[model samples]
Target: MVQAQDASEEAGTEASGGDEAAEDAQAMMTDESAIDDQAAREFFTSGSNLYSLGRYHDAALQFQQAYDLSERPALLYNIYLAHRDASEHAEAAVALRLYLEATPDADNHAALTVRLENLERGLAEQEASRVSAATAAEEAVRQEQAERERREAEERALAEDDKNIIPWIIAASGGAVMAVGVVTGIIALGLASSLDENCEPAVDGVRFCPSDPSLELENKQSALSTFAVMTDIFLIGGGVIAAVGLTWGLVRLGGAEDDEDAPTVSAMCGPTGCGASMRMGF
Candidate 1:
């Protein structure tokens, strides 16, 4: 009987030891759960602070972390709210769908489902608008490029036309010189008429002046001779220059018509003299 009582005491000690071990394990699990809850609370507070500061995307990330730690359907709703405020419709829809799936018996399930459909439709419209804007921008760039090319082509053609401008300038200069000659001739004729009216008839082409001959009559005769010489010089020189310019222009025009790659000729006239230049390309 004494040995039996000793065995019972030994069994009682083992059972008490097992109870202590089980209690310790329960305490450890409780501590771990408290740590997790504290971490989740910190994340939830950070998310709330970010949302209040209008940092919606950052808030969404914080709330997602909270939801991961807590596995709470309510935290998913907070994530959806953050994503929605940030205009992340797709992400908001995903979060809301996850919340609905996690909590099938939610009171607002029907309303939330309708809202998801609307969000999806709006997302589709947004995508379509973005594509249309991109296409319009591409078309605009294409039109601008084509317009630039056309303007460049016209400028090139104008540059080619400018190559023939020297001939016209020479011709105009010659015409102006000829006009001056005609006016000088007219003045010479007027002076001669005045001289004839004042001078008397003479023998051997020597005019006989009055005994008291006026100095004005002699000056008039001198002026008439000078003007006549000037008229002849101007008319002849101007005619030659004009003819040269016109002939050069005709030759260039003919050459251009015959061959696009023909030799080119250019003429110029100035106060000193007139000149011709030629260029040949092979």
Candidate 2:
């Protein structure tokens, strides 16, 4: 009975020694992990100092190496700073968003808040300025189009006015020519009547020349002269009608032109050279 009790006690002591050895191993691993974390932190601080002094590339390398060993949120924030100093805005924004997500409560909360607000405000202002510029460009395009249309319309109106004037001028000239031709015909007819009367035979039934030709031609001459005068009067009346018709047609065509094209607004600048132009069209 005494030997059995002694063997059981020895077995219990061995189990306790084994348990202590396992605990000591775990403690050593914990200490090693803490030391590694401290080293990483020191490397990150050194990189941050370099970045502040404008050594961005070196800082990025250090932060990158530290991150490879341990993916800590604070180290990611340092990586963001290095990227920002190097003018890598896209990469910096990406890293910063990730870091903020990991640790929303960093040590420098007030400074972080101010920086975030400033970045947001700057981005918003830039967007607003871009929108305003776009709107201005659109307005300029619209104004140019309107001006082109107005100029085109003015040319059309001028062409139409010229068209109206040309027909009137042609008609008036044609009427004047017709009047001259009719007057000439009347003069020719009168001359022909005078010649025919002067050369007529005295005895009409026998068709023989009279002894006194002057007495024989007097009546025939008078009748031919009367016919010539009548022709001249009719030609004069036709000429007058043609002239009136031409004038009336031209006046009516002129009235039919667009009213909006009558008035124009124009702008000029400088002493000798002109600047921008502005015009209005109905």
Best by TM-score: 1
Let me know the TM-score candidate 2 reaches against the reference structure.
0.46
What digit string (tens of lDDT, one per residue) describes model 1 on residues 18-60?
A: 5988766766776777677777778888888899999999999
Worst 10 residues of 1 by lDDT: 1-10
Which digits, one per residue and each the tens of the lDDT, describe model 2 over residues 146-237? 99999999999898767666545655664665566576566656655455554554343212323555654455445444544444444444
Q: Model 1 TM-score?
A: 0.55
lDDT against the true structure, per candidate, is 0.74, 0.59
Pairs with backbone N, CA or C atoms under 3 Å apart (clashes), candidate 2 = none
Cα TM-score per model: 0.55, 0.46
Worst 10 residues of 2 by lDDT: 1-10
